[model samples]
Target: MIRSILLTAATGLLLSACAQPPLRGTGDLGVVIERASGSVQIIESDSHTALARLEGLGDLSHASVVYSRDQRYAYVFGRDGGLSKIDLLSQRIDRRVIQGGNSIGGAISQDGKLIAVSNYVPGGVKVFDARTLRQVADIPATPLADGSKRSRVVGLVDAPGQRFVFSLFDTGEIWSADFSQGASPKITRFNNIGQQPYDALITPDGRYYMAGLFGEDGMAQLDLWHPERGVKRVLGDYGRGQEKLPVYKMPHLEGWAVADNQAFVPAVGRHQVLVMDARTWRQTAAIAVAGQPVFVTSRPDGRQVWVNFAYPDNDRVQVIDTETHAVVADLRPGPAVLHMEFTARGDQLWLSLRDGDQVQVWDPYSLKPVSTLPAAAPSGIFFSSRAQKTGY
Candidate 1:
């Protein structure tokens, strides 16, 4: 009896030790931000299903997520300046910190050791240690020339050589902080880049950075390869002839809008998507669209560009043929279409229909819905693939 009891207990302990969640990889996983609930739902791209919902993330009114280099963690930047590092494997927030009063967006460094956030409340950029959520560096937005008020920082992105670049909306300037030497970053500022620079994007190759000016028609370009060349004004005459219309919501220059040696962007205060030649930084053509464009996204193959519009026409999504610069397809997903994201391989397209309380998956080529998943006021759909991209 004693021998039998020993064997049974040994087997019980062995079973207990082996009792754990099934192992899985994170490459196929992603997250959807539920803005109303202040939570994010972990999802699987292959199955098109919601695996888990992790909550308690604060103030997601304008939340954006960037993944860790290993794709194991997601760094979420919230409007209330809450930085939450979520572990994808365990499906929980591993560490979180309130780093600022107001933050717009953030980026992870090329080496993935640092996370930089752009703020508006205190108007500065804060660098934090990725693992522990510890603040490593604080670079305040350069105060205006008079030294009265700090400028609100926008368009923050991680460039090559462990550097972070951003634009100052209040000061019309762009600054680059190089952190390769040590904790203290060497700062480089370019003033008068443009009036009211709203947002910016870096090219796929990390060679050029473009800032879209809201106070004026043109955009300011900074060639990362040659800092001495300074900012070159492009599309300077874009909005000259037409009467500028009221902007319902500021457009985003976030997505990788470059395709086939051409860069595509949303025209401010107009119903068009501007096409520019990547080589010369000159406006090639402006394709008229359904309404004021919000997010202009290109597929992984760079064959087509998909655009979503602002308020009154928020329900519509228009597809542009990159080769011909023409509207090929116009789709109305639903009311309150907040954001759009494509799978890593560009096999499927996902859109957050806030009014419909669902995330709709579709065939980008056919413009047909594949499936709809329920969500509570979803805003942004981000994939782990962005972890490897330069200007994600």
Candidate 2:
């Protein structure tokens, strides 16, 4: 009788232990893009360790990912027009579809109901149901008056009111499509924004959309709040009277940093970052940088702007103080530093070094290396926190 009672009590204790919820790991999860192998390394920002590696993603050379609203799904936009919906918790691809022949990147709707892809082959934006990956709407980049061929679309982003905005590389136009009404989206196109809008970014507040022009000296801005006022070209003639250097690679506008009402934008072919007043839309100052700047991203806390370069200087990264407008720290993580991502609270920074095949984490305030995780030709490091923001 004593033995049976002891066994029953032990079984009851085991069941009680199992009934309690499993201890949750740190919620700071993210993914690092392995461009060469077409895979992504799931990592925890706090632990600085890779939890899993998901493979078989096609042509991730220029891949980008946006997370679902609940932070459970990752919508990966592949260079080959493949839209893959990944389950972050399960570390598996939930659903995927070939949306187009060639694609650049994509965005998720504000409400997490839709996903939009910018295409290079068909020259248009295709919207898909975020849950089912079903085709919802297709808006073509129609030809402008100067040409009969459709233009390639790039710089796609989600806005506040269930709208997706993008720029046309060939037509020099910016467009916004409203999907609040469902399958048939209402479209608005602004013309003559600039020449060769290589990339674009929407401000965090979702009020302004800025496109970096490669063929011209400045950028194009659209006030989303007042679209009838049309697109305004700002920072024009920035490189006037100076022989601009040949651009080896187009600087990405997605890296443009905005902090404390100032915008730090990469000067196309110059080894400098252009500072502009976000309110006035005027050039405030130019900070000389190490090399041709590609991404000038502001830290989450708005205290510093981190800048990365292209090609020859791609191995280095520089941080600028927002208050002083000065280059603070110049860091060399490794060769071919492709991207940088800060933790949601701005405590740490994760940088991907393609040539080194590793991701380095550092203290954002002290500029000290904290940890490193091995990866394979990593490019973009995206955090799950991005699921809550307008544009990631």
Candidate 3:
């Protein structure tokens, strides 16, 4: 009897250990801010429920959310330059890093060691330590000698060999940096890529980096290792003016969906996701989507791509098949569906609805609504690594 009881206890302990949750991520907390008051609301992704509502943030207009590598903490930036650090699991605001600047965009490094945010008003970028949430480096974005407007660093992507790439708005250039060994990240100005290469993404294998074009109807690609020879145009002029109406606009190449060496890029003005062969950087085909597709994200398996947008009518999200490149299902979560993200498991999708004051959850495969998580003005939806601990 004693031996049997001991074995039973050991088995119970093992089962309990397996049931324990995982760690948090830097970019996992789903944030919704009250547009009028800047009230911050956080939802712990594991529960699909409200974790906390923080008040008195004071009108954080259009804040950006990026979680840590582990998803334990979230770094938020407001338009007026308010930066708040939130503990995802504990459901509390850890600290406000700084205040005052035109903080527009932010990105966590690939290794999750460094984070950089754009300061449009004061002019430059602020680099923070991802682990401790400390200000480590500040790179001043001085205007070029030609008397051009001061360029704002809008988007950032980290590549292999510990290198980082950032997009410059004024000069329309992609800047490269190495933060692995340098004291301050070294910025090497690469050749210009099109008129305005707004945002960029590194391939999964870290071979090439592609930048989204803002001024025209195409994108630019660069060899990650070379960097200096500069970028080549990948997609442009989809016979739009001649064949159909102009479908793309400036700075809207926002969504990137990658599946099996193929990059699905949404040329928003064109209302289609252009499938490109990542190996050759050639256009395979374009998938038709409904009105003004704002963001394109996918599940872990890369089988389905989710596109969210406002317009031809109300805001909605559509799921597309990666293999077929066709619209599989349409999910109308709410109005102003700005961004969507999938859990690490690829089971559930979270939607950040701006107008409805809630974040909606859906089965990415079935396209069925599971739950509606309330928030004031949810701009972006993310799943922290910690929030995925409950096996979500």
For every model shown, the clashing-pair count is 0, 0, 19
Top candidate by lDDT: 1
Q: How far is each candidate from the true structure, as Cα RMSD in Å?
A: 2.3, 3.9, 7.2
- Candidate 1: misplaced stretches above 4 Å? 1-22, 145-148, 238-243
Off by over 4 Å in 3: 1-37, 56-60, 131-134, 142-149, 238-254, 386-392
lDDT of residue 46 for candidate 1? 85
lDDT computed for candidate 1 = 0.89
| Residue 137 in candidate 1, Cα distance off native in Å | 0.7
In the range 74-105, model 3's lDDT, one tens digit per residue, is: 77777877777776656667777663467775
* TM-score, per-candidate, Cα-based: 0.94, 0.91, 0.81
Which ranking of candidates, highest TM-score first? Answer: 1, 2, 3
Candidate 1 lands at a TM-score of 0.94
User: Model 1: per-residue lDDT, tens digit, 1-392?
Assistant: 99999999999988976764447789998999999889999988889999899999999999999999889899999999999999888888999999989999999999999999999978999999999989999998978778877899999999998999999999999999999998899999999887889888898889888888877777888999999899988877543233378788878888538888898878777898888888887888989999988898888898889999898999999999999988999898998888989998899999998888899998987889999899999999999999998877
- The positional error of residue 153 in candidate 2, measured at the CA in angstroms, is 0.5
For 1-392, candidate 2 gives per-residue lDDT tens digits of 99999999999999998866344632588889999999998898877899889998899999999998888788999999999998777778889899899999999999999999999988999999999999989999977567666799999999998899999999899999999897899999998888888888899899999887767677788999999999987888543224377676677777888888898888878898998898998988999999988888788879999989998999899999989988989998889988888898999998999999999999998999999889999999999999988877
Pick the winner on lDDT between candidates 1 and 2.
Answer: 1
Residue 274 of model 1: what lDDT? 86
